[model samples]
Target chain A: MKIGFDAMGGDHAPVETVKGAVDALSLIEGEIVLFGDELKINKELSQYKYDQKRISVVGTTEVIENDDKPVKAIKRKSDSSMVVGMKALRKREVDAFVSAGNTGALLAGSLLKVGRIKGISRPALCTIYPTMSGASVLVDAGANAECKSRNLLEFAYMGSLYAERVIGINNPKVALVNIGAEETKGTPLYIETYQMLKETDLNFVGNVEGRDVPSGKVDVIVADGFTGNIILKLTEGVSLSIVKELKNQIVKNSIGKIAGLLLKRNLGDFKKQLDYSEYGGAPLLGVNGLVVKAHGSSNAKAFMNAIKYAYIGVESNLVAEITEKIKTMPAFEAPVENEEENE
Target chain B: MKIGFDAMGGDHAPVETVKGAVDALSLIEGEIVLFGDELKINKELSQYKYDQKRISVVGTTEVIENDDKPVKAIKRKSDSSMVVGMKALRKREVDAFVSAGNTGALLAGSLLKVGRIKGISRPALCTIYPTMSGASVLVDAGANAECKSRNLLEFAYMGSLYAERVIGINNPKVALVNIGAEETKGTPLYIETYQMLKETDLNFVGNVEGRDVPSGKVDVIVADGFTGNIILKLTEGVSLSIVKELKNQIVKNSIGKIAGLLLKRNLGDFKKQLDYSEYGGAPLLGVNGLVVKAHGSSNAKAFMNAIKYAYIGVESNLVAEITEKIKTMPAFEAPVENEEENE
Candidate 1:
């Protein structure tokens, strides 16, 4: 299988993307098709030693900047790496597409270019949240800020599948993210979502609060994009701040500085466990094809981990599984209609 | 001024409450009216040395258990410490009420017993988010999970007041918490709220993403309770997990073990900053009377800090200020009504 890599994306762009693609070739058996300006891609590729046959560069002139609006940029910049890589994925020229560029752009391209799976109204951006027990997958992390009950229902199933097939959690415990563990918490949207989520055949674990997310008691936590985005980013912000605090604390006194020297390796390991990059980038699930959105500030190692995700997504047939799962799952009875009919 | 202490509330009951009241006596001139089983409160208070005249006990027959439904429990248990404390505050027997028990019960009593300020639809729960620069006040942290645009505007002004009057940030920079920094980021509620918030005489800093809260870029971040609650608790979860992770990392090996000993002091200082107890309790703002909800797991020190918050809230006349501020501010332009009138 061939993987299309958006080499001209993310903060490090061509350099890290090229190096990451080369790193992935060492692990998996897939040809890497780099989509970017050929000169820049070749310049970065020259430094790495790899079989020239395993990697190929596709030249694209336009580059989507980080600040560009998602829908506008994707529609305007036809030759951009993100847009071009998506085209390759659409035509089935590549098995999957991966980009670490503008998250908004990648999400838009997934819907506009690669398109949504038939019958799925919205494609969710999954975020891999690191927890004490292991990892929890949060869906619609920033895709739809506002969601209907059906959207949440779809996310629950999609997230559960990804957790089971890709992450290898058997019978993954699914929970709705709410203010309280009780069914009564959250707004009207959550209340409706909770009622429907519990009725599903999935291993429903009821409600899990924000505090429960990092605790990792539940395997998957589904939330609307607005709430999910806040949770995802707040977790990142808190982790970053804590790491910063730890580094500052380590150098305070002579004794503390000496102690930091001894604990450096363990500290690094702890940081790795907390880091999102270790899980690779989150795949934009519920779409017609596999598309991974890596962190915009991704380094080579982060990008490589994201590339590995492409391998997992393809091998697990996550999209097809979700599509099939969608058909078998009981449909969400519209709350308004159901209530009206009952009355 | 006098403060009513719910001596039977929280995980640590009369023991912690009595101890915290004793601790507060040295700093403040107010009398502490303890509400609980008189015998139990007196027995706990006997251990601590303080002015007998400064502290008094008001016996109550019932206690609100943590698991009880908030609104029902408050209505049924008039003899409970939380309800009795609110009653005392309503009658001007105490300037403020502080509790560490069931959060919902305290919030319910705050509305049902003490009541909301004139014109405030729903009282907000203000959580003091500790950021790198300083502390930022997040209003409606877990109060109204579903909010209209007007509710958010009320929270923004209330948060700004609390930040300025209590937290001591002069003309605090206020920002709306959204999925994105753009004004068009969140749902229709946020967009309308954003337009009105800009028109107010607040130190309006525009939209702040989730990361900005911990980064301490803005002094007040106002969000509908659904988003705010998730942000508040997620921060707690992340901090708790990081603290747990750090403890594990500190004892990995002999070298690390020794490093942990030397670095203990710095870690303690860092932990103190992240500790919710350090800031005392979160204030239930927008109510007619001052009510502070201490953490359920609060110890003596945490209870004392919460009591300290009570003193600050009363001294600043926070509720009165919010009431006055609400009246002077221009009303939120009803989008549909305005459009219809224009046509």
Candidate 2:
């Protein structure tokens, strides 16, 4: 199987991306197709020794900066690494695609180029956040900002499948993110979504409040893209702020600094657990092909992990499973019809 | 000025509530009217000694438990401590009302009894969250599930006034919370809210992402109730989880325990900074009368701090200021018209 990589994406592009590709090629039995400016890719590749036959480069002329408008960047910078990588996935030249470039651009290109699954109205970006118990998957993090109840139910189905297949959780509990845990406690969409999810065959855990997300109470927490994005970013901010405060306290005085040294070993492990880059990448679910979005600040280790996760996505046939489920599942009744009938 | 306290509210009711009232009465020069079962309140109040003139009791026949539905609980349990305290606020017998009871019930009671300020579409529960730089206010935490752009502008107006007058932040920076910091990154409602906020006379900071809330980058972050509640509770969960994880790490081994002991002083300071209860209570803004909602798990210190905040709200004339501003400010133009005109 062949996997396409955006070699010029992320903070440590080309060099770290190349190193990661080399490492993945050695460990996994797959062909690596690197997409970027040929000169930069070759320069980074020269330092690494690996099976040359397993690694190949596709030349691209431009890079999408983080500040560029997602749709505009994807359209104008057609020869950019992200577009090139996604085009390969669309053309079936590669089985999967991975990029740490502009997140919005990756999401936009995946939908516009690689396209969504046949029956899915909206695609979701699912990210695994570390919790004390393990990790929890939050879907629609920043994908479809405004969603109906049917869209949220689809997110649940996709998220539950991803958690079970990729994250290795059996009968993963799915919960709708709401202000309160009661069925009638959220917006009309959430209340309606709660009803729909309860009717699904998945392990629907009813409504879960925002406080329950970080506690790792459920395996999958689904929401509209707007609230899901807020939860994801807020969790990241709180974790970073706490860690920063902890570090500040640890080195404040002589005794504290001494304590810091004594606890340095444990601190490293804790930091790793909080690190998003360690999770490899987030999957753009409901898409027709496997597309992984690595953190924009990813280093070589994170890039390597993203490749590993991409391999797992392809090997586990996540996209096919999601597509099949969407096809076989009961069609969503028209929202207006359902509302009128309920009344 | 007299302040009404729901003596039967919260997890540590009667005991902690009475202790907090005693503390407040001793420190602040205000009359405290404890509202609850006369016998139970007096039994707990007997533990503290203060001027008899400073403390009094108002009898209530019922109590509202945490699980009761807000509207139903308020309607059926008219003589409950929360309802009795709100009644005092409504009758002008007290300057403000403070409760650590069911948040929904307090919010419902505040709106149903005290009424909304003229031209205010919805009252918001605004909370001052402790952050690295200082505290930032989040409006419409869970009061109104669905809010329009007009409601959001009013929230911004009230929140700004509260921050400036009560929190003493001059020219407070107000932000509209969105999935991203860009002007066009959120739903149509956020985009419309952004335009409305930009036209306002307040110190509008434009759009802020969810992560910026905890960073204390802006003085006030305004959003529709759903997103605001999610951000608020997610922050709480993430903060608690991190602290819990830190404590777990600190107590894992004998060496770690020794290290924790060595750093105990600094850790204590850190914990205090992260503690939400230290910030006192969240105010139910836009109400005609002052109302503060304390955390349900509040201890004596938290309850006292909330009472102190209520006194500050009354002294600052926050309600009067906000009401006057709303009356004088131009009526909100319907956003649908503005969007069409702009297009």
Candidate 3:
């Protein structure tokens, strides 16, 4: 098996990507295929000592930027590293594709180039969100801005499968992120989704309020991309702000400075628990091919983690399991309004 | 001016309420009317030495609970302290009303008893959200779970007026909380609201993503109640969890314990900055009369701060300003699609 890496992706580009690939080579028995400018890839690779037989470079000329519109860029930049990597995954040239480039472009390429598994209505961007107890799989992290009940039902299955398959959790509990905990709470969409989830065989814990999200009572949390995206970013912002403020407070006076010095190692450990690098990349699930999206500012370590994530997805047969899961589910049908018709 | 205080509200009931009222006597030249059982109010008031003429008690028997359905509790419990206090405000017996009881009950009483100002369609729950730079007024905090663009428009105007009048900010910057920073981003409701906000005369600073919220780039952030409530609770949850985790980490070892003891005062200062008591209560905007909802678990300091918040609202003629602002705005009319007929 081989994993395709977008060597031209992320802020550090070929340098960190090359280092990450070399770092990942020791962990997996599979080959690493680098897709980017040959000269740049080789130049970065020269700095690292690795098994030359296991690494190969498939040079691509173009690069998709963060500012480029998702669909337009995906359609126009076919020669780009991200698109080429995705194509390789589609053709089974590689087991999985990983990129820390533009999230929108990766998602667009996943849908337009790689396509989705049959019977799947939408693909969700699922992230492993860290909580006090442990991390929970947050589905539809920022893929679909608006969603229907059917879409949420699909996310529940996909997210739960991800937790069980790749993350190695058994029969992970699933929940809907909502304003209130009641079954009747939230908008018309959530209320309908709640009923649909209740019917499913998955361990569907009732609605979870925003405050309870970090409590880690459930394993998988599902919501529309809009709400999910907000939760992801807000949690990040609040955590960052608190840490910054805490540091400022700790260094304000002589005693504070001394105390801060003594507690430095413990604080570092605390920060590591909330670090994104520890969690690896967010996966674009429901796609026919395994597509992982790393952070834009990913460093060597984070990129290496992303490669590891792709390896796990490939080894665990995530795509086949998801396809089988979708096949077994009943086909979706829009609810017909008999009551309104009678009225 | 007279302010009605719910003597039987909050976890620390009559004790905290009476103390809070007495604390306000030195700060304001107005009378405090405590609404609850006369015996309980008097018993708590006896502990505090204050001007006898400045404080009075109005007896009430029933109490609205946190678990009670909002509308049902308001309609049935007319003799409840919350209901009695609402009646006093509606009858112009008190200039303002303050409660730390059930938020839903307070909001229900605000709309049903006190009514809304003429030309206002909805009353929003606006909270002063703490941020690194200072604070932002978050409108529709949890009042209307679902809202249209018209409701958002009203919230924007009311929230802006609040920042300018009560919060003492000159021409506050207003922004819509969305998943993306662009105008075309977010759900249909937010996209429409963005367009509507751009057409207004307010200092509309376009869209703000969740990560930018804690940066305090804008003074007034507007969102639908569902989104706003999630943001509010998630911020609280993340902050609390981080603080708890930090404390746990600090006392794990001997060196850490010594450092923690030394850093206690600085950490206390840090916690104080993030404390809700420092910000006081959230006001129910667009109501015909002033109504402030404090935290349910409020202590004497927080309750006192809530009273001060009410004093500011009453002194600023908040209701009159909102009434005049709404009167000047064009009446909302649903858009009629003439193009549909042509098609």
**In order, what lDDT does every prediction score?**
0.85, 0.86, 0.88
Best by DockQ: 3
The runs of at least 3 residues in candidate 1 whose Cα sits more than 4 Å from the true structure, single-residue gaps closed, are A332-343, B332-343
DockQ (0 to 1) for model 1: 0.75
Clashing pairs in 2: none
Report model 1's TM-score to 2 decimal places.
0.94
lDDT tens digits by residue: candidate 1, B1-343? 9988899988888788889889988666778899999999888888878889989999999999999998889889889988888999888899998988888888778777877776666678898999876799998888779988878888888899999999999889999998888888888888999999888899998998887689898999898887888888889888998888888888978888998999989888898888888877988887788888888888888888888878988999888899898886676323311111100
Per-candidate DockQ vs. reference: 0.75, 0.71, 0.76
Place model 2 in a CAPRI quality band.
medium
In angstroms, how far off is B232's CA in candidate 3?
0.8
- Chain B only, TM-score of each candidate: 0.94, 0.93, 0.94
Q: List candidate 2 stretches off by more than 4 Å.
A: A332-343, B332-343
Query: After superposing candidate 3, which stretches have Cα over 4 Å from the reference?
Result: A328-343, B328-343
Local error of candidate 2 at residue B97 (angstroms):
0.6
